[model samples]
Each structure stands twice: as C-alpha cells, then as structure tokens.
Target: MLFLKNPQEAHLQCLTFKKEGKSIGFVPTMGALHEGHLSLVRRAKEENDVVVCSIFVNPTQFNDPTDLAKYPRTLEADRRLLESVGCDLLFAPQEQEMYPAPPVLRFSFGHLEQVMEGAHRPGHFNGVALVVSKLFHIVQPNKAYFGQKDYQQYLIIRQLVADLSFPVEVVPCPIVREADGLAMSSRNRRLTPAQRREAVILHQTLQEAKQRLLNGVSVEEVKKWVASVFAPLQKKDIRLEYFEVADGYTLSAVKDIHRHKEVVLCIAAYVGEVRLIDNVLLFS
Candidate 1:
C-alpha cells in the first residue's frame, strides 16, 4: 500500500486514477484501527479499483480537550492493518495540512443537528462536517464508506453531501460489532477490563427495547425500562446519556410506537470515562 501524508500529493495520486478512468473508494477515519475500520476498507477494495483511507484525528470534532488528549493513536499498527486489508493508498495528514488555520465556515443541519449527539456535544458535527468535507475534496473518491455505528453522524454527512453537492457517493455500511454484541468503536480501547464488561449492557438494553417496542409496549414504558436497566450501575459510573426512539430517517422522536412505520432505538452512555454509543432499528 502506498502512503502519503500531504493532501496535495494524495489528491494528485487520486487524480491519476481519475485520468485513467478508474473508480476510487474512500474511508475517512481517526485511527486506532480495529476490525470495524478494516471492514470498511475491505468493502471499499471490493467495490472500487483504488481505495483511499485517511487517518486524521480531527481536533474540531472533540468538545473536551481531555477527551481529545485521551483518544488513541496507533498509526504504525493502523498502517499495517490497512495494508493487510489491501488498501491502495493511505492519506494520513497532519492537522496543519487539513486545517492551516481555524475554520471559519460552518455547516448547519438545523433540526438534524439539534438531537442526540448534537445536543450533547455542541459544535461536534460542524467539526465533523468540516473534516469530512475537506477529506471528500482532498480524496475526491467515487464513493465514501461510513459505518452505521454512528447513526446520527451518518445522517449528517448525507445531508452535507446533498446540501453542498459533493460529487461523491455516500455509502452506509452496517455497524460491525463484537461477538458479544458490543458495537466496535475506536473509544473501546480506553475501556477498563471491568468497564468493558459493563459496556455490553448498552447493546443489551437496545435489544430489549427493540423487543418491547415490537411487543406493543408504549414508548414511555420502554424508556422507563431502559432507565431502570442502568439505574443500578451508578456506583460503576455507567451513566446513560440519552435513550431515544425516533424515526429512522428524520430522527424525530417517536411519541407513539404505533404511529411510526420505521423507527430506531439509539442509546449513549459512559462506561466509566469512556463514552459509548449504539443503536438498533426497532422496525423498518
């Protein structure tokens, strides 16, 4: 696999592919590579002639400075994993290259940005949009792959593409999870052994919520059950940030389960200091 740190150089390399009438598949990630990330690369390789993967832990995306400092960075191991997955080019750029100065322009999703992760982490998706827009421009791939583990983020990026008219196809891949049903995440590296055991409960709660919602339980009752599931873990520092059941597309909160055709169960919580998120489509 070829690696280039400069965005200009990477764009030039991708341009060569375009000149040769080749298709490009892009996977943008903040590194600490795991099977979940490699899963996206493998799919990209299968679909496009040249696959470009980028590893830049964008500073703008993190609302907490400590959280930013704690994020794992294992570029060497990440590179080896990318190469093993048959990635054609790796565009790992420094923050300065991606953001020579503080970004002035902002992306506003309005109602789309007003719920869940957006409500918790202010200015988070704007930063996400900035980085994704930059990488989309720098790589200019035919298609870009994103995991559904970040279901809300997936929606925001799709809006970014449609609103701004980025000439790239946005592809949504399924959330790759552990055998125990814990969704794979870069933040999973920070979980203590005990916290790791506790983290699986997020998925478990979502599974239970889905069944309850399907079984004619009221929306309020399901929410109550989910809250009770985590009430006993207070001493463990496992706190539920938010539990939302909403339309799968618009993300509007579902007041009545019977009224919605397609809805999802989204949950966020802290397994100790590590914040984790997971979701399931209650019905489609």
Candidate 2:
C-alpha cells in the first residue's frame, strides 16, 4: 500500500485514479486501529474500486487539551491493520501538513450541534467539520464511510456534504461491538482491566433501555432508569455525562418514542477518565 503524507500529492494520486474511471472509497480515522474501524475499511474494499484510509489524529477536533494529549497513536500497528484489509492507499498526514496555518473557517450545523456531543464538547463539531471538509477536499473520493457509533457525527457530515454541494456519497455502517457487547473503540485500549469490565455496563444499560422503551415505557421514565443504572457506578469511577433519547434524524429530545419514526438512545460517560460514547437505534 502506498503512503502519502502531503495533501497535494495525495490529491494528485486520487486525480489519476479518477481519470482511470476508478471509484474511490475513503475512510478517515484517527490512528489506533480497532475492529470498529476495520469494519468500515472492509466495507469500503467491497464496494469501491479503490480504498483510501487516512490516519491523522486531528488536534483541532479535541475540545479538551488533555483529551488530545491522551488520544492514542499507534501508527505502525494501524498501517499493518490497513494492509491486512487490502487498503489501496493510506494518507497519514502530519498536523503541519493538514493545517499549515491555523484554520480560519468555522462550521455550524444549526440544531444538530445544539444537543448531545455538541452541547457537551464546545467547538467539537466545528473541529470535526473543519478536519472532515479538509479531508474530503484532499481525498476527493466518490464515497466516504463512517460508523454509526458516532451517529450524530454521521448526520453532521451528511449535512456538510449537502450544504457544501460536495459530490461524495456518505455511507453509514453499523456499529461493531466486542464479544461482551461493549462497542469497539480505539479508546478501549486506555481502559484498565477493571474499567474494561465495567465498560460493558454502558452497552448493557442501552440494551435494557431499548427493551423498556419498547415495552410502553415513557421516554422520561426510560432516561431515569438509565440514570439509575449508572448512579451506582460513581463509586466505581464511572460517571455518566449525559443519557438521551432523541429523534434519530432531528436529534431533538423525543417526548414520546411512538411520535417519531425512528428514535436513538445516545450516551456519553467517563469510565475512569476514558470517555466513551455509544448509541442504539430504535425504529417505530
């Protein structure tokens, strides 16, 4: 697999592939390969003639300085994983290469940024929009792949494509989970063995919440039930940041699950300083 660090060089390479009538599939990631990430790459390989994966832990996306510092970087292992999945090219750019100077542009997704991650992580989606727009320009792929674990992000990028008139298809893949049902994450590496065991509670709580919502429970009651599950985890160093059940499309907090065609349960919490987010979609 060819690795290109320069954006111009990567653009030129993709241009050549475009001239050859090859459809490019791009998977953008922060380096630290995991099963969830690989699932995107594998799907890209199946659907497109060329698969391009970029590994750049974007500094701009982190709202907290310490979170950026603690974010994992396993480039060598990431490269091996990409190769194992038959990735055609890897555009692993440095910070300077991606942002030669500070970015001046900011993006707003209206209400999409008002709740969940956006409300909690100020300037988080703006940074996400900045880096993703830059990467979309650099790669110029026919289609881009993102996982549903970050369902809000998937929605933001979809809006980004439509608003900016980018001719790229945004594909959302299903979430990949561990055998124990914990959603796979690069940050899973940061969890201690004990924290790791407790992490399963995040998914378990979501599953139980899902059943309760289906069994004619009120949205508010369901949310309170979720809080009850996490309330005891405080002693174990697991703090719930937010647990929400909102419309899957508008992301507005749903008063009743039956009112919306689709609803999603999204949660963000810290399992001993390792912030983890997971969501489950329920269709009516």
Candidate 3:
C-alpha cells in the first residue's frame, strides 16, 4: 500500500491511476480505525480497482474546541487496518497541507441544516462540506463510500455531488454495530466501562420507539417515550440531548406520523463526556 501525506503528491498519484484507466474508490475518515471503518474499506475494495482511505481529523468541522482536541488519532494502527483491508492508497494530510488558509466560503443546505446535528453544532455542515469537497477534488475517485450511521451527512454529501455536478458516485453503507446493538463509533473508545454498558440504551430506546410507532402510537407519544427511557439513565450520566421523528428526505419534524411513508428517528446524548448519536429508519 502507498502511504501519502502530501495532498499534491496524492492528487498526482490519483491522476496517474485515472490515466491508466483504474477506477478509484475513496473512503474519507477521521482515524481511530474500528470495524465500522474497515467495513467501508471492504465494500470499496469489492467495487473499485483502487481504494484510497483518508485519515485526517478535520479541525473545521468541530464547533467545540475540546471535542476536536479530544478526537482520537491512531495512525499506526489505522495504517495496519487499511493494509489488512487491501486499501491501495492512504492520504493522511496535515492540517497545514489541507488548509493553508482558513476557509472563507460557507455552504447552505436549506432546511437540511436546521435540525438535529446542524441545529446543535453551528457551522458543522459547512466544515463538512468544505473538507469533503476538498477531498473529492483531491482523490477524484470514481466512487466514494460513507456509512449511513450519519444519515444526514450521507444525504448532505449526496446533495453536494449533485449540486456541484461532480463525476463521482456517493455510496452509503449500513451502520455497523456491536454484538449487543450499540452503534460502532470512534467515540465509543472514550466511554467508561459502565458508560459503555449504559450506552446500549440509545439503540434499545430507538428499537422500542420503532415498535411503538408500528403499533399505532402517535409521533409525539413515541418521542416522549424516548425521553422517558433516558430519564432513568440520567443518574448514570447518560443524558438525552435531542430526539426527533422526521421525514427522511426533508428532515422536517413529522407532526402527523402517518403522513410520511418513511421517517428516521434520530438521537444524540451525552454518555458522560462523550456525546454519541444513533438513529433508526421507520417506514410505512
């Protein structure tokens, strides 16, 4: 596997691959290499001739400085994992290489930015847009893979590709989870042993909510039940930040749950100092 830290060099190498008629598959990640990340690489390897995995912890995306500062960086282990997954290239750029100057431009995603993650993390999607746009340009891959764990993020990148008319396909993979159903996340590393056990409630609550909605419960009542489930966990330091049942496409809150054919139940909470997010899609 070729390990590249320079963006210019990575760009040139990808260009050479293009000239040679190779189809490149790209997976952009903030490193802390877990099975969930490797799952994306495995899918990419199956679909493309060459797979390029990037492990840059983008600073622009974090609204909270402490969160960025505490973000994990495990490059050596990440490289080993990439090599195991048959990744062809690794573009791990320094902040200076990625951003010689602060990004002055901003991205607007209409109402897509007004709820859930965007509502909580101001300018988060703008940073996501800028960095993803940069990576898409640098790799110029025929296909890019992202996990559906961040469903909103997947949708935003889809919009980014369509709006910008990039000649690349955005593929969304399934959310990988632990054996006990906790969604796999890099932040899972920060959870204390007890917090890790308690974290399962996030997924369980979503599952219960899904079943409740299926049983003719009101959207408001399902949302309230989600809060009630988390209420007991507050003593355990698992606090619910927000929960919503919304249209999957527009992401607008669904007042009448029966109106939408498909909606996603999304949640975010503080499990100790580590904030985690998870969701389940409900379809009628």
Candidate 4:
C-alpha cells in the first residue's frame, strides 16, 4: 500500500487512477483502526478498483477539548490493518496540510443539524463536513464508505454531497458491533476495565427499546422505560445523553412509530468519560 502524507501527493496519485479509468472507493476516518474500519475497506476492495482510506482526527469536530486531547492515534497499527485489507492508498495528512488556517464556513442542515448528535455536540457536523469535504476533494473517489454507527452523520454527508455536488457516491456500511452487541467505536479503547463491562448497557438499552417500540408501546412510554434502564447507571458515572426514535430520512422525532415508513432508534451515552452512540433501524 502506498502511504502519502501530503495532500498534493495523494491528489496526484489518485488523479492517475482517474485518468486510467479506474474507480476509486474512499474511506475517510480518524485513525485508531479497528475491525469495523477494516470492514469498510474490505467492502471497498470488492466494489472499486482502488481504495483510499484517510486517517486525520479532525480537531474542529470536538466540542470538548478534553475529548480531542484524549482521542487515540496509532499510525503503525492502522497501516498494517489497511494493508491486510488490501487498501490501495493511504492518505494520512497532518492538520497543517489539510487546514493551513481555521475554517470559516459553517454548514447547517437546519432540522438535521439541530437534533440528536448535533443537539448534543454543537458545531460537530460542521467540522465533520469540513474534513469530509476536504478528503473528498483530495481523494476524488467515485464512491465513499461510512459506517452506520453515525447514521445522522451519514445523512448529513449525503446532504453535503447533494448541496455541494461533490461528484462521489456516499455509501453507508452496517454498524459493526462487538461480541456483546456494543457498537464498535474508536472510543471503546478508552473504556477502563470496569467501564468496558458497563458499556454493554448502551446496546442493551437500544435492544430493549427497539423491541418495545415494535410491540405496540407508545413512543413516550418506550422512552420512559429506556430512561429507567439507564437511571441506575448514573451512580456508576455512566450517563445517558439522549435516546430518540425518529424518521430515518427527515430525522425528526416520530410521534407514532408506525407513522413513518422508516424509523430508527438512536442513543448516546457516557461510560465514564467515553461517549458512545448506537442506532437500530426499524422499517414500518
């Protein structure tokens, strides 16, 4: 696998693929690679002639300075993971290379930006949009892969592509989970031994909530039950951030689960200091 750290060098390498009529599949990520990340790269290998994976933990996306400071970076390990999955190119650029100056433009998706992850993490999507747009430009791939763990962010990037006409297909892969059902995240590594055991609750809560919603429980009542499940975890410093059953496309909280053609259960919580999010889609 060819590893290029400079944006111009990556662009030039990818340009050669374009001129040769090769299809490029891109996976943009904030390093600390895991099975979930490699899963995306493996799928990309099947569908496109070349796969480009980027590792840049974007700074602007973090509302909490502590979270940004604590984020993990393991380049050597990430490289081996990518190579094993047959990734063609790795665009691991420095912040200075990607952003010489702070970004001034802000992207707003109106209702999409105002709820769920956006409501909790202010200015998060804007930073996501910035880095994604930058990578989309640098790689110039025919298709881009993103995991469904961040379903809202996937929707936002689809919107970004539509609004900006980025000329790349935004494809969402499934949420890869651990053996215990906890959604796989880079943050999962930060969980202490005890916190790791406690982290399973987020997935358990999501599972119970999904079944209840489908079994004729009212939205309000289902939310109450979910809260009650997490209520006991507060003592352990594991706090539930927000849980909502919403329209998959519009992302507005659904009053009646059956009313929407596509419904999704999304949740976020903190197991100690690590913030984790997960979602399960329900079709009506």
Candidate 4 TM-score, true structure as reference: 0.98
Give candidate 3 regions above 4 Å deviation.
Answer: none
TM-score of each: 0.98, 0.99, 0.98, 0.98
Tens-place lDDT per residue, model 4, 71-101, is 9999999999999889999989988988899
Residues 57-157, model 2: lDDT tens digits: 99888989999999999999999999999999999999999899999898889999999999999999999999999999988999999999999999999
Worst 10 residues of 3 by lDDT: 253-262
Q: Tens digits of per-residue lDDT for model 3 on 65-106?
A: 999999999999999999998999999999999999988998
All models: lDDT? 0.93, 0.93, 0.93, 0.93
Highest lDDT: give the candidate number.
Answer: 2
With candidate 2 superimposed using the best TM-score fit, by how many Å does residue 75's alpha carbon deviate from the native? Answer: 0.6
Candidate 1 residue-wise lDDT, 1-89, digit = tens = 99999999999999999999999999999999999999999999999999999999999999999999999999999999999989999
For model 3 the local lDDT of residue 76 reads 99
State the displacement of the C-alpha of residue 188, model 3, in Å, after optimal TM-score superposition: 0.3
What's the lDDT of the predicted structure labeled candidate 2? 0.93
